[model samples]
Target chain A: MTLSPTERSTIRRGAARARTDRADLHAILDAGLVCHLGVQIDGSPRVLPTAYGRDGDTLYAHGSTGARSLREAAEEPAVCVAVTLVDGIVYARSLFHHSVNYRSAVIHARARAVTDPDETWRALQVITDHLAPGSWEHARHPNRKELAATAVIAVDLGEASVKVRDGGAVDEPEDVEAATAWAGVLPLRWSWGEPEPAPDLPPGAEVPRHVRGRGVR
Target chain B: MTLSPTERSTIRRGAARARTDRADLHAILDAGLVCHLGVQIDGSPRVLPTAYGRDGDTLYAHGSTGARSLREAAEEPAVCVAVTLVDGIVYARSLFHHSVNYRSAVIHARARAVTDPDETWRALQVITDHLAPGSWEHARHPNRKELAATAVIAVDLGEASVKVRDGGAVDEPEDVEAATAWAGVLPLRWSWGEPEPAPDLPPGAEVPRHVRGRGVR
Candidate 1:
């Protein structure tokens, strides 16, 4: 649970409450395979949750071949990318003190647009496979038209902070002795269920073992 | 599940995908509440998740009286407040294309620091009750210094947006027949479990019915 300082935020509260070790950040990111991009467009902010993948210290995101917003994000450079996983709710004796124990990572940095067709195509594959292992090989690869319509943006791993809250609720010592109310944590969990194949598939298309063998914490 | 246009994001893809009605900007704010504030501090960006509540279209956040960051947030006119809920994961055949179904609201506006003692106390109650319903009445209210140390920041709900993705993955027609990879949704849920009492209690305090009741979706 202890992480080196570089993976930590400078603000004491921001760092203490939310710890982002490499393992912790990667686990949270890999579990859901999606992220929300906070963009301040013309001083107006917008949060766009989309599919994303981390390669080393760079996070990669791709948009539909013709998506204008993402294209603009690539052009803008400065943006905030946030990803979170809610582990549970902290229920305390006092209502004013309830909280959620969650794991999250936020990157505040400029992104560079990946314009090379080859790099974009490979990045797309890396992103796709990150979401589903063994997927790029199973599905048809995008053609030239698809490549032309897409935009890829990469945000560096620097200037990032990770925060996490886990375990039971922390209550005031006096509140512990007072017979007034209950205090504890209500755990939250995410699980992968049995795979359901597309209804219109050819009869012989059985689900792959890797696809069905999901990992849940 | 359809919500008024005001409840949805103007950018289309950013709107809530589930219970659009409950997904309305105000409704999401009114529901069991807390928000994460993202700010750029000391050359790094940090997102701090904390307790919050709403009055009309304005969102108020209250932090520990000794919290310097909250004080700084209050001193400023606008800050970024984001509330997000993950509903499920969209496991598609292609790895690069995996997505999540979620409901989220983001507000980027100047927050006027509320300095009136009475307003600060009221904001505390709203934040407290928002975390655990009916507990504020039973818990000890903040006294003078605690009140002084606390900071309350109210951000206007304008210049905001909500985005979401729901249901099963939308696969390509041809991929549906050949994907052989399974396709479906693994629903994500947030639930409150039975409460655990503080260990040193006088041994007779039972959890209140409302505190023990199941959370609403």
Candidate 2:
């Protein structure tokens, strides 16, 4: 299935870089841990970086009930959620062509506040599992009070655009032929470092296999 | 000098995590490579990840003149720029306490379109240098056409907020004492991989020391 890009979701600036495949959108969203949520507040636009999770075609973002951005998002006519993953820095012979090889997804929707208990519980698990792969099963579930204090907002992925630039620098023919400057890509590598056990943990507690197995990519 | 948080800049939900130090704001902004630019378009909020640079108390963001977000930001009364650096993933005995160790700065300001030639040139250099430490000097400078095709916007950092969370999980006393689940932090390590020279580069062209010396932290 292809993404049904609405007028707002269409990419006009770099139209060639926009991807229409639904799988591309899902891949970009799944790889990101945090998304910048944009919502109108007091007649101005505000963006906040918050944790998020994806379940099929719906993206879930949760925050404390007191968060003004979340509250405003729930009430706003539409909100924008953008997830960007910078894969590498593209170096061109000319400074004007310097760019970052990245995959970015921007979704526009009227986010619905999730109030159903069962859905909230599932959304919380999806969020936890996204951040820490196995934590949802190992960690204690959210208590009643904790659940009540959190606000979950769901954004549909139907109206979204995914743009990706993965290739090396695209420089002018003259600059490429001159070749006076070095041009290439410096890939950005993200990995999980050695786990630092909680300071108050009992002495002999070992880092679980789930954590240890999350080796460097 | 401490950051003078305006009514909107004041972080209400995570009050304790809100930082008042001016140095903290600069540090977080300098450490990030990309920032999420938020602006209202057609009465709806839109967020896009874009390149930015800082000069003292001002932040400059630039994009192609054809970009809609930049045009709207220049006309809007206010826009929010958010930079976030995730340091680690915090795991807690309880899902409710799980968090991310991050340093984030959000600036709210009226972005001014940079029209002065000299200021635009300097801003472009600042932005280029920020992304590729020494590229401004090594690469060919932008000519008249390139300069005219770019749109630069400057935002004052007078009204901003910085929030940081660096420690381990803060779990309930009961969960900590119970010790049924492993609790700790998985630091997110970002590094520069081996530079892949451009395929079109002359065979003998060597990677510059400035690019090679960007070693893993």
Candidate 3:
């Protein structure tokens, strides 16, 4: 299903770079490990990085119940969650044409404060599995008290927009032909390195296949 | 000088992870490639990933002059600039303890619209140097019309907060001893791949040393 762009979600200047494919949005979100969440504090805006997980069409962000920002986000104005994967820095023959090649998904919605125990448990599991894949099955799950202190905010994906800029920069007619400038893309890549074991691990501890495979990334 | 945290900039939840050193904030900001800029639109929050440049304690974000968000930010309530680097994914013996090792800097302030020609040129140079080093010197500089079409927003770094989380996950003593879970941190690394030249490039054009050396990273 494609995302329905609202009047607010439309790309004003660079309309060609905007995407409507829901799958593309999900791909960008899944490829990214962190998201910047925006919550209004008082009359101003505050943006912070946090971990997020998606289950079907719903996105989840959790923090300690005592978090002031999270509490404000759940109660008042709608929050914004943005996940961006920068592919490369585009160099054009002309300075005005230079841009970054990126895939970005932006969602605007008021996240529901998850209160039901079952939903909260499910959301945590989804978040855990999203951030660390094998650990949910391998590690101990959250108990009663742990759940009590955590707050989960669930935002529907209905109101969202995806913008992507790929390939080489577009330069003007004269500059494109006249200049001998080195113009292209410097691709950026994200890779997972070897897992470093905790300092307190006992002797003969094994690096599980989950860590070895770099699952869920 | 260190950052003077206001009531909003104070880290209420993870005080241990918050750093007041202004140098730390600059370092975190310098190392990041993209920042999520948040601006409130019509009472709802909107967050989008944008490229930025830092000169001294001032950060600059540029966009099309016709951009609505940029105009609003220059006129109304303050904007938030957040840069986050995911260092690693921490897996603990217990699921609740799972977390990510990251360094993030968030700045909250009003952004001024730069209209002066000299300041706009300087701001563009700072931004270009930050994204692709040596390009400002290599490529043709912006002409009159190009500068007129671009809008630059300058934000101060006074009311900023830096939160860093590193090392292994902290699991409960009982869970660590009893559970046989593989606990460790899966490190994430970002690197530049070989530069891909523009499709319209001449046959024998050379890749500049700046690109070869991965400058400004």
Provide chain B TM-scores across all predictions.
0.85, 0.97, 0.97
Clashes of each: 20, 0, 0
- Compose the digit string of candidate 3's lDDT tens values, residues B1-217: 7789899899988899999999999999889898888998898888968888999999998998898888888986689999998999998998888899999899999989998888898999999989888888888889989888899999999999999999887989997788578788999887888899988888888889877788434
lDDT of 2 by residue, B1-217 (tens): 9999779998887789989999999988888999999999998889989999899999999999998889889999999999999999999999999999999999999999999999999999889878888898899899999998999999999999899998899999999888899898999999999999998888788999878887542
- In DockQ, how does model 3 score against the reference complex? 0.84
Model 1 lDDT tens row, A1-217: 4333543344465346755466776666666556777665454444565678777777899887465557667767467787777766676765445677777777777878998877777788778767665667765566666577668998876666677787775777776767466666666545665565656656776776656674554
In candidate 2, stretches whose alpha carbon ends up further than 4 angstroms from where it belongs are: A215-217, B215-217
Docking band of candidate 3 = high
Q: What is the TM-score of each candidate against the true structure?
A: 0.80, 0.98, 0.98
Interface RMSD, all models, one decimal each? 3.5, 0.8, 1.1
The candidate maximizing lDDT is: 2
User: Model 3 Cα RMSD, Å?
Assistant: 1.2
Q: With candidate 1 superimposed using the best TM-score fit, by how many Å does residue A177's alpha carbon deviate from the native? A: 3.1
List the pairs of residues colliding in candidate 3: none
Off by over 4 Å in 1: A1-8, A14-21, A65-69, A95-97, A117-119, A193-197, A203-207, B1-9, B12-23, B30-34, B38-46, B65-78, B91-98, B177-181, B193-196
Q: Judging by TM-score, tell me the better candidate of 1 and 3.
A: 3
RMSD of each: 4.2, 1.2, 1.2
